[model samples]
Target: MEKIAITTDYITLGQFIKFIDVIPSGGMVKYILQEYTIYVNDVEESRRGKKLYPGDKILIKSIGEYRITKQ
Candidate 1:
């Protein structure tokens, strides 16, 4: 379980870009979304700008499961 520190209560699309270790940055997310290569809570997430809240799980095939948490 890797922890991503977030000062804000919710994780925004822009902020998530900083977490490149788990997922690629910039156009990468867009590419994934366009290809339906991402999932949120088991459902295929096509919105690259979707906000992730605390306890929310964003799953990428290459990165596995990443849990969003508030710091």
Candidate 2:
């Protein structure tokens, strides 16, 4: 799995998606969330505002798996 390091306690799903370059802008987060099937810690997630903390695992079917880490 790819590792994504974050400096903060948590990052919103939308921000993470943008940070990974999955979408062009934050405004597209809603659209991308609807188009892609994303899982967080094994649970299917759809909320763009979902807070992801260090050690969280994310799986995006069309993309790849990722693990959050402290930066």
Candidate 3:
């Protein structure tokens, strides 16, 4: 799994997606969420506003797995 280091206590799913360069802008979050199946700690997630903290595991179907960590 790839590790994503963040300076904040938490980050929104939409922001995370952008941080990972999955989308060009925040406005594309909705479209990407609708196009892919994302799982947060084994639970299916669709909310762009979903808060993700350190130690959280994210699985993006057909993309790759990622883990959140503190910088």
Error of 3 at 33 (Å): 0.6
Lowest lDDT 10-mer window, candidate 3?
Answer: 23-32
State the number of backbone clashes in model 2: 0
| lDDT, candidate 2, 1-71, per-residue tens | 99999999999999999999988888999998999999999999999989999999999997999999999
**Cα displacement (Å) at residue 26, model 2:** 0.7
> Distance (Å) between predicted and true CA of 6, model 1?
1.2
lDDT of 2 at 51: 99
Give lDDT tens digits, candidate 1, residues 6-69: 7787766445744645345665666555544667767777665678888877776665667777
List per-prediction Cα lDDT, in the order shown. Answer: 0.65, 0.95, 0.96
Clashing pairs in 3: none
Please give the lDDT score at residue 18 for candidate 3. Answer: 94
Per-prediction TM-score to the true structure, in the order listed: 0.70, 0.97, 0.97
Candidate 1: the clashing residue pairs are: none
Name model 1 segments beyond 4 Å from true: 22-25
Model 2 spans with C-alpha error above 4 angstroms: none
